[model samples]
Target: MAARKIHTLIVGAGQAGIAMSEHLSAVQLPHLVLEKARIAEAWRSHRWDSLVANGPAWHDRFPGLAFPDTDPDAFVAKDKVADYFEAYAAQIKAPVRCGVEVLKVERGPGGRGFRIDTTDGLYEADNVVVATGAFQKPLIPQVIPADAGFLQLHSSQYRNPDQLPDGGVLVVGAGSSGVQIADELNQAGRKVYLAVGPHDRPPRSYRGRDFVWWLGVLGKWDLQTPAAGAEHVTIAVSGAQGGRTIDFRRLAGEGITLVGRSGAYQNGHMAFADDLARNLDRGDANYLSLLREADAYIARHGLDLPPEPEAHVIIADPECVSRPVRDLDLRAAGIGTVIWAVGFERDYSWLEVDAFDAAGKPVHQRGVSKEPGIYFLGLPWQSRRGSSFIWGVWYDARHVADQIVTQGRYTAYDQSARARQAAPESAIHAAAGDPDGPYPHPHL
Candidate 1:
């Protein structure tokens, strides 16, 4: 079959793609969004049944749509988030084709456009935008022993405690997911063990306001830094408790055993590093740094806000301290399940282009790729610290849409000028059907 031609071809149907589509439609540009699965597939299938968005509903709104009348501070559940994306797409009349898994994307013939091969069919486009997001693949450690006599699952695959056998649960990695899952398992009457790592534990609320509000007021989301490394920390917050901090010390007090970072699994035993205390201290320091920055920003702006509230104290038990376990016998300890919540990585192997750095990451300037007519969206630190968040994608998408429209107009004008130059004056006059010669419009 002949390949379909599109003006703008957008990949993915999540917040990024939807935002881009909305912007493109606003500018009266024709575009098509292709999704490998349903809209918001990650939020629908990868998250746990009870999982909720990390941010409040009010803060998670994308361009041209806001959350329905509800508790603004409430964390939206996964199913509701998925539904919101679906409703937003329908509301905007986004031209999205679901279940169209893209196999490869490369330069088209003669280097005039992009060639996209997908499950649906071959598609050629003048402009291509990648909105697949940074967290495309789960990062599981290569050192995890395959023969270990226990069920191991990534946090993405874990739904609830009932999925595991009746035994102690070992949660490797103490980021938000790891800590939250450990807390859930502990509450479910199972012995839960959390492996401590370097993390940032920010307070959920301060001065009678949610931390997210403070971030907005202080313009934290606008700050742009380098991309996060593999060991990037997370805010220790829980959606279950109305977006409150999941205090590790409180979890330890509730009888959840805390161990250091997992080193390796060998001979039915797991080795742990001896840096739990240091990790905890680093987390505390990071929280303090954030608070200091907020306070300084408030003072600098001379805003008459409420006085700072007294700091909440978290008491960590000695058992949860830096105790190095050279070897932890899983069988003897009766631990039957291991949950790896390390993190996620992006895989761009399907993108056949020379627009990546040595690190295999796309080379882009504020969502605009180095390659002409190619762009990226929904990446952490792509344009700002919040670029990866739902609220932030709108800015990047709008910018990309403007670039596409401007470039498209310029290309059209260039082609029209070339055509006029190639045609004879008599032919041009005949084509114009006017006594005066046909001159291009100034704007064109």
Candidate 2:
């Protein structure tokens, strides 16, 4: 196509990207979704055969449509999710360009809108929505000492427990990934070791009630306004409120050994944090506080809820190795496989914008950034419950797309325009403090 300026451009064709495209379509806004890889590439690349949606099918659906599976509690396989995304893209006829990698997104020279440079070509748009999820890169903690003998693999690369070596497996991080991997290994008849950390222990549902039901009732998941900063803590079902826990007790009952935080794994032994329980307690408190706040909201709103009682966590560690990784020697014990299921971190090196914080994340509120016309979607806890999940992208997509529509025609910043209305040089004062401070420092 020739050099044509578009109304809006959404990067990524995954769930979030497609959802955003649908919202734009609804508003009759002209837009295109540029996908770096094939649609739902994340799900396609998950070669694991046993991968399933940790939650139910009814809850794992995208906006305006539901997965056509019968099992509500059944886990949707990776390939199926990918297929669903493809079908979704087709169903909505989302204007998507596949195999187009966005190399850079920045203010076009004079701030006239965003210049999106891709591998295939270049396009200009009034607004850009980066719906890339947070799982772009795997995060491996530096605390663990590197050794020549041990093979380290992040959870993203792992597919099945049979791929592991003959020795016992050391699974780091006790979140969903950690617990699930450890459970699979143990079920495979291997001596599995899981490292416990602060996590939610919510039941999939309470008394035939989906957890979101309670959230909806409480209005905790209904945060529509933009937050000033990130949430310090989240609720966990695994604490004293046992009902919501992810059934870790059942895993322990099945012979999976749980342990404290893994410190540094040098020669062999892994040292764990001495105050593991204390740390967990603090995390649990934060989670409970969030839940209480949600409950308060429901009560105040007069949400009609059943008289079903709330459940708490039942802490169990039958095969738990409470010692830290630094104190345990795996080399001597013949534990050769090390699965780092800690989690993923976002890396924004490719995003050439000036609004990024020290952590390399784009600073924004309600999908809008200080950098005009730049927005983000599908971020973890971006808004409320649906922020990070596959089903939650539509909410953000609609909100951001609406912004673009309301903004009307976009104007790129030009040098001549800046020169005409530019403020005096003395008017721009320098900062007197550290450059690495919270907000961007104009003074150097």
Q: Summarize candidate 2's per-residue lDDT along 1-444 as a digit string, tens digits.
A: 644578888888888899999998998988889887899888877435566665456767775667775566555777888888899999999999998898988788676778888887788987888887777888777755565577788888888877777888888877666766676688888887777765554444654556655555656566764344434223333211122355544666777656677776555568776645554555555445545655565568776755334444435434342433336677775678888877777866767877678878778887877677788888876776657666666777788777766555322224323543565554323321435422322221
TM-score of each prediction: 0.91, 0.79
- Report the C-alpha displacement of residue 162, candidate 2, in angstroms: 2.1
* lDDT of candidate model 2 versus the reference: 0.69
Error of 2 at 294 (Å): 11
Best by TM-score: 1
What C-alpha lDDT, on a 0 to 100 scale, does residue 120 get in candidate 1?
A: 92
Steric collisions counted per model: 0, 41
lDDT of each: 0.83, 0.69
User: Which tens-of-lDDT digit does each residue in 88-182 have in candidate 1?
Assistant: 99999999999899899999999989999999999999989999988788887876666756888889989998989999988998877888788
lDDT of 1: 0.83
Q: lDDT of model 1 at residue 339?
A: 91
Candidate with maximal lDDT: 1
